[model samples]
Target chain A: MQLNESDLSWRSLPGTLPVRHAVVSREQLLLLCRDVAGRGARLVSLWGEDRRAAGVGYVLVVVLDLTSRLLLTESISRSPNPGFPDLSQLFPSAGRMQRATHDLLGFNFLGADARPWLRHSAWAKDAYPLRHDFVAAAVSAPPLPTEIYPFVRVEGDGAHEIAVGPVHAGTIEPGHFRFSVVGEKVLRLEQQLGYTHKGIEKRFEGLSVQQGSKLAARVSGDSAVAYAWAYAMAVESLTDTQVPARALALRALLLERERLANHLGDLGGIGNDAGLSFGLAQFSRLKEDLLRVNATVWGARYLFDEILPGGVATDLAPTALPILLDSLAAMAAEVAVLQDIYDNHAGLQDRFHGAGVLSAKLARQLGVVGLAARASGQAQDWRAALEIPPYDGFAIGSVLAEGGDVAARVAVRFDEIAESLQVCRGLLTDLPSGEISVAVGKTRADELAVGGIEGWRGPILVGLRVAADGRIARCHPHDPSWLNWPALEHAIIDNIVPDFPLINKSFNLSYSGQDL
Target chain B: MWKILKQIVRTGLVTEPAPNAEPRLLEHALHADIHRLFGRALCIRQVDAGSCNGCELEIHALSNAYYNLEGLGIKFVASPRHADALLVTGPVSKHMADALRRTYEATPEPKLVIAVGDCAACGGVFGEDSYAGLGRIANVIPVDVTVPGCPPTPTALLQGILAALQSPTSRVDKRSASTYQKTEDRG
Candidate 1:
């Protein structure tokens, strides 16, 4: 990979770019990231603004490495309107990221796939919401603006398109999916999301760093702990602040509990969808029991508003220690019973075995990550890979399965639950005695940092840029769903429409999370 | 038949509790009316206008063992016609306005509307967003109960449903409400 110390007239920070400088041209910047990406670097964040700096408008793109955790910045003048060479050709998943950049900012990624990732008719054709000139309080955009969106269609005698949701029968998130199907089998499934898009990124523009963290937590309620912790990590890194040992442990504990709760509920629900009510009953009970223990130990059942900037809101009580141990013991036993049932049940096995098979090759090609990826034999888990503090203290074993099917996903969850329970038990036994939180002092302005955590779903990454007055300049909480959502469409290809719920449940991609 | 019998035998005599499972004693306590309404069967139909899916997750979680609504007479019906109450979880999207109204209309009389989550209650964070206009369920339909939470836990949803069934201290005269104050529907 090539490295350059190209000069940028814009602001520069110590840890931002490797060389304490930025590339002047967008081409050089793109090439630098391209080189690093070619050498197997996962670009974490790409963001910029149309700033009137030095009497000129400029857009910057910052990319980071998944391995080194280093940041690189690229800037170009707005006059030439330079576009980054489409990294989508190099990384298929980059298509969405590049498309998002194109949509929000006016910057383009040349020769990228044509489909707009999030341009879901929410705005007019010419309107760019992320632009500096774009008014925040604009009530309406011009109506009936037509734009082309490409979806590969299958032509046959009796084939038709089935448009589902944006509004669905079941209580779920809104996302429009147009399915070209013949009979029960789906030929192609194209998704149109951003129906619940609340302009969270735009709203984060002027909030204080601490308040921005609260907003990050709400990006997706299910992964609130992950998002909050990520934001905290970013800010802490910016301030070069090291959180206390006890606070780190508490955060880790909460994170594990969050993962466990979500997994149990999802595992059970997937089973229920497959007509295995026994799994549903048992797993759901375990999940509920776990959440109750959480509410008693922590404040909330879903554990909302517990995680704050520097550390947690409240400390785990000395009285609650033994209770947590007992709850963990109960969870272990109950999970064992459910696993036994899942293992031996012929009907459940039949339904789960080969259904929704996502091959390992396809998973890699599609850049699928998280448990869904792990189930399909992609053994990368960010918590273990990144060697974050509490996780560093523990032996984090990566779970994998060769089957790449619904059964494999179930097996992965079962393994993860066991591991999480074990981790929780370990935490309880080795529970630290100290203050749960420390007061996070006022954040310095122009501070930018990146935070990442291995959430139950996958890596929850957040990038925070604080303005001069300690308000947020930009805050982007990237959910694992951004990488995993497309995998669902591919996984459902040959599967019948009747089993769509099962497949969808298995992945459980968050629409709000992705939209943010 | 044999399989069902064998399964029942294996599971050991599955039936509704003789003295009620003490609904409030479950980890997250249920409302008193819900405790009384336990095993008093009624079908529930859920409507989604535009939610973040948090409320839906809790609703799905309700079927699990700890606060199993099935143990009480509460059931999630597949069809609106079969339902006695409508459990709406969303901010009432402009696109879904028609479908939500139609579903409510399809439900039988003495129907209850239990708006689940902060989104359904007051649109929560998504309240002021462009797409999610008229944030609460009460804005669209006459809501009988509101369970305020970023997605209230399953127990809270149960409580809300129970609260809906209970007789209110002050009731609006229906004749006057239908004609004059139709615009002002209190949830």
Candidate 2:
């Protein structure tokens, strides 16, 4: 917690969690960002809120992860032309976040790239959806043709361009990719996402704090538990509700299960993309088994809508723990066998080794987070690093690989799956006995809280602010993909065009999460 | 390779039997005629309009050893041109509406459209009020059958696809199917 002289005035906000807020002038924004980055703080999220009704023109909130604590700095720009100095020059990952803020709120980040990141020509240039004056009904009108987006061009002797889809051949989410290639080698790769934007952030504006959890869960379906828990933590922190210890353990259990399920699926996907169908079949089977246990015990396969604002919606039945333990034991044994196969196969090795390599230097430069960061030698795991709640008591090992290639990503996933299984078994065996939920009364008005959880992908952070009437003034659910997507762009550099799918699947950044 | 072979031998025939081909009463009443019109095999092309990827996960499970959708003469195709039906999930995002329409147009005639998941059926939590989503799949393209769940299970999704394929009409006109009416009533 170091604040430089440029930080105009700072105050520590009272909440369940410790959060320090600072008000900086527009002139000090860039220098403050540089100072913070120089002190080893990583930019977690950046967004703008329309506080015009409060006579404050607009506010830019910058969230940073300081390992031991979370720092949220807010700068009110009361200028007729409300904007702040850009931090993208200091943190390259801030480029997209700043661009998105500009697109949705009409606030300028001076000196940052001004290209539309999430807008995608859906509305008129002057119409910023997140503004207080903007009407949702206007979106029903037909949008203009968004055929020609300006992608950076490469002019060279043998340079050729390849365009993939917003509508892909697979049953995956939609996103377009443009590759600048010389023969098979990719010179540059640019992604155009936002095909899945559903006005999620704007929809959260008028809802009660309790109703906001439902919206958060859908921010990214794969990370539903993470988002829901983080949202609950933010609301509970605002309301000053201490969740039951049993509830915390249950949340950790669900989070670990989510991690295991996703890792199984991704391991299969990575192997399948590398031309190993056997791995796909085996891992998909294992993932399905895990999901079935979730459905039988938790009442939903994907575990959607299971976590609520106050606490979780369901509890493990008295008779169900033994069954769950048995299933976990069986799955662990099978995964052990699969791991041996993955490590032994030489053909798989040929496709994975040295393909789509992301160096440790590039990963840190882009501020990459999550499993992808760990694969590239950045050992920043929220569970281990933050030491929050149940994880603080549990022995969660940080898995890292130095290769930073497809093999490294796969290895990380494998290691994480094993570690998560141990965590889950520990949680189940030492299950505390108590109520799974607490009544969360009205939240404190005019309060803001930050909640960060170690989601399957990485750290899922939610910055929540309550209005005077206890309504949600702003809720920004920042996904780890925001930090990792740019890393994907860097990872594919110099890799052949055909290996793009394998590398992309290796990272597997969520389009819906980032698009929102 | 020998180890893999030994493991396979040890775990011999772990795959379950193919799902029952006997169509249910509703499926038989609606799609019995079409079953004979097209061959037994059905080619499905899945389009994710704007789902949270929950439905997509279950849809992928249909290919695993337990569900074994391919063993039942059903398979997911890569191109809409070769598809007999379009299995769509998610609330139709404004950006994806045109792509969904184009995919529908590309699918050969007598194509079935099955909207899978609560989002696809009636927009789920992100309802019609959303600016970026049109709410339901039918808002953008004609959906023949609607499967409702935050994310429908693989069994329900398979049944929806099967029912759509069995329905006599290749492509049902928008809002014409009894299944659509049923889905609306439930929602």
TM-scores for all candidates: the values are 0.86, 0.94
Off by over 4 Å in 2: A1-18, B14-35, B168-187
What is the DockQ for all candidates, taken in turn? 0.30, 0.57
Evaluated at residue A420, the lDDT of candidate 2 is 90
Compared with the real two-chain complex, what DockQ does model 1 have?
0.30
Model 1, A1-114: lDDT tens digits are: 354433334344432122133455666676666666666665555665655533446566565544534454657666645466666665667777777776666667777765
lDDT of each: 0.71, 0.83
Lowest-scoring 10 consecutive residues by lDDT in candidate 1 chain A? A12-21
Candidate 1: segments with Cα more than 4 A from true spot: A1-24, A43-50, A53-65, A68-77, A80-82, A140-150, B1-42, B48-50, B78-84, B92-111, B127-134, B138-142, B168-187
lDDT string for model 2 (B1-187, tens) is 8877876676665555433464454444434443454555678899998888888888999988887787666788999999878999878888788888999999876678889999999888888776677889998888789989877888887777766655555354332355567779999
Among these predictions, the greatest lDDT belongs to 2
Q: List the residue pairs that clash in candidate 1.
A: B39-B73
